[model samples]
Target: MVTQTPAWVLNDQQGIESLQLADNPVSTPKDDEVLVKVHAASLNYRDIVIAKGEPQLPFFTPGVTPCSDGSGTVTAVGSKVKSFKAGDRVCTHLVSGLSSSSAPTFTDINSGLGQHLDGTLRKHAIFHESALVPMPPSLSFLEACTLTCSGLTAWNALFGLDGLVPGEGTTVLVQGTGGVSIAALQFAIAAGSTVIATTSTEAKAERLRSLGAHHVINYRTSRDWGDVAKSLTHGRGVDIVVDVGGLSTLPQSFKAVRTNGLIAVTGLLGHAEDQAAVPTILECLINACTARGILLGTRDQFHAMNRFIEDKGIKPVVDEEVFDFLEAKEAYRYLEQQKHFSKVCIQLE
Candidate 1:
């Protein structure tokens, strides 16, 4: 007997309104794959950009599902599957076929789940056993769903081979209170680093401080917040800067980082016009700082991050407004508004 699953597809020809629910036939897992009953999925800014058919993110095919982050229970495993069983709870990795070499590009076949292949925004999805990790027992499905993209991106920025790898007494600057930034804040704190967080409002700044931020900067009130961040560290500047704002904020990150510091360029939330500016590259060279572009991490990094989260008892800060699976479009709209403090999750069951 065949099985059917409900999913949302992005059709470039139809625009945002065309993203409607459709029923898809669930394929049997190949010898190295596993079938998952996806229970929860999370939203990211990239989803909104993709839904709007942005020219830069041309990875979506007409009928492809749209999200990379999800958590579920394993319903079946193929003959060759060794790590997971039918009853195990699991979360997916954003990219597959990643090893220590990391030689394959993002365009490689099966490299990115939501981009290069079908994603996890469905009731049931099949993935290679190697691309899935056991969910941390301390988290719910909604929270676990967030790990695949935003969480992993933060983890990779801080701990990957080219990452910052903060330790005791290290000072790190994180921008805003979004999922990745908040995850970075928590991870830095757990690693015994001093966190300097930036937010747009005082209320949000206070909230960030409550979440173990050693210092909070209101970027709105202080346009030259980078210099102010440097002042707070007594002119030495921070050891690492997690720059999610891309070009618009990169200038400030350049000012805030210490000489020989590491800056992880992770997102492009700033304006397009600002992105074209070339001076930021010169600034990085002038400051003698290393700026690395971070992608989602490998399976080994994902497993290690989970162990850290478990050991530290860290909880992912999910937004209060949880949407049902049928309200997937609404979830996207909410994320587009960018008002949510952390993760916006869609519950499937």
Candidate 2:
């Protein structure tokens, strides 16, 4: 029988302000469930949005266990569980529902472990064995923790949608230095594409360049960033634009991509504060570009991406600031500032 444990719960609808830590019983595995002793976890912008509360909480765990991606050790498994045993180091996929052994259909509300059910902010969690993947031996717990969300999302954009090929010399334009952007930049560079990364400040521009960006654009200085992007491409524009800032940066992004280029919409960054406009769509069509909405990728894609990162020794770009599990709220605040170049993580003991 699984014992009780303590977990952090979102106290109320004031968003991050509502997070409250409390003790709750740890659930035992029913059939294929595995009990995980979570060691590390990372936050995403989606977690922040849910913490703030919404009427339609599409797919996430409720209350205070807010983060989606985490890594841990398997301590116990249900009678029917296979593929994992005690002492296995593992990370879970974003859509826990898809991990169901019966091949989940559309009805599972808690398809994602952390979103609709309690997530890894707690010391222990009960997840289906299908939700788990062995942690890459090459990656530390923190680095592996990023895979389930941003890492997978980046993987989907490059390989799934764009069909990125190594040594292709195609140009990949990544927006800003957030988790997805940095992940995309890393993958693009590894795939032998020329990377053009945009940042709001000179400091971040320097960092982006240091991380293998072939060129860095300070969108702050170059107000007409699309023209600059086009100029940098020698007026050809880029082949792929990792469009993270959906509506706000949409117009500029449209102008930067090449004819037949692939634009993967990965995030909003407050750009989707309002709905996207028709002109943006019109312009993209005029350029003959392909636009796709990217979500966290599939399990097959996750393994593929992991193999790539592991083989290449590509470490995730992480923030210098580290937070203990108790300081989860402060970590969210830091993420909100948009100052972090990569992922903001909370370390659990």
Candidate 3:
């Protein structure tokens, strides 16, 4: 008899409304694969973009599972899978086939999990053993799931090439209180760096301060929050800026960062119209700043970040609204509304 598990499948034509819960046969792992029984999964802005049929994303046939972040326990491991075994808690890495080289290029067509292949929105999924990382003991499955995407991107942004060596004197500017931003805030604080966080409301500003942000900017009230961010740094400017807002916020990132500071572009929250208005090359050149685009990250980096999280007792800020497996669509809807302070997750026990 074949084992089957329930999964949420995306129909390209109907969009999110077409995300139907159905049973899928559990496949036996290949020699290098591991079968994970998914316990929790989290939403990202990129998932919504893919559901809306973004042209730049890889084309998926209708019924593809759509989410890149998930955590689970291993149910079975292939004969060659020595790193993990049945009953070990683990999380899937977003990228699968990237070489473990120090200078690995992430621009390859197969760099994404949900984009190029079936993702983790299913009850049971098979992944190469190399793509699985042990979950940090400090995190629950829900919190661990949040790390696969948002957490890893934040890790790569702050620690990747041209990244910040966060310490007492180092300062970081996080664009908003979303998953990536909040993760960056926590990581930077743990590294002993002062953080300047941006938010749209006073309530959120206080929440950010409570999370160890030294200064919080209510960008809505202060339209020139960039200059204000610089001011908060005693006119020296922040050492690093996690620019999740894309084109709409890049100009300000340029203004807020000191000469030779690093700006890591990791999201596209800006409008399409603003794409054409991104700051000119002269602005970046004048600041002597370095801007680099970040994908999720390599499996090695994911493991390293997990170790850091475990060592620091870092907890991902999952929103209070928890959805069941059947309520996956509602989870997507909630993420679309963008009302949550941090990560939005679906529990699939």
Instruction: Score residue 290 of candidate 2 by CA lDDT.
Output: 85
Index of the highest-TM-score prediction = 3
Worst 10 residues of 3 by lDDT: 101-110
Q: Give the Å error, residue 138, model 3.
A: 1.7
TM-scores for all candidates: the values are 0.94, 0.91, 0.94
lDDT for residue 19 in candidate 3, whole number 0-100: 80
CA lDDT of each candidate? 0.84, 0.79, 0.84
Query: Which model, 1 or 2, shows the larger lDDT?
Result: 1
Candidate 2 per-residue lDDT, tens place, 1-349, comes to 5587767787565777778888878877878889999988888887777776664454344464667789999999999987789899999776664643232233442346556667788888888776788888888888888887889888788888535443467898888888899999999898889998888888888888889998988888887797798889899988888888877777778889899888888886744434645246667669898887776766777778888988888998778887899999899899987767789888886
Better of 2 and 3 by lDDT: 3
| TM-score ranking, high to low | 3, 1, 2
> How far in Å is the alpha carbon of 129 misplaced in model 3?
1.5
Q: Which ten residues in a row have the lowest lDDT in candidate 2?
A: 100-109
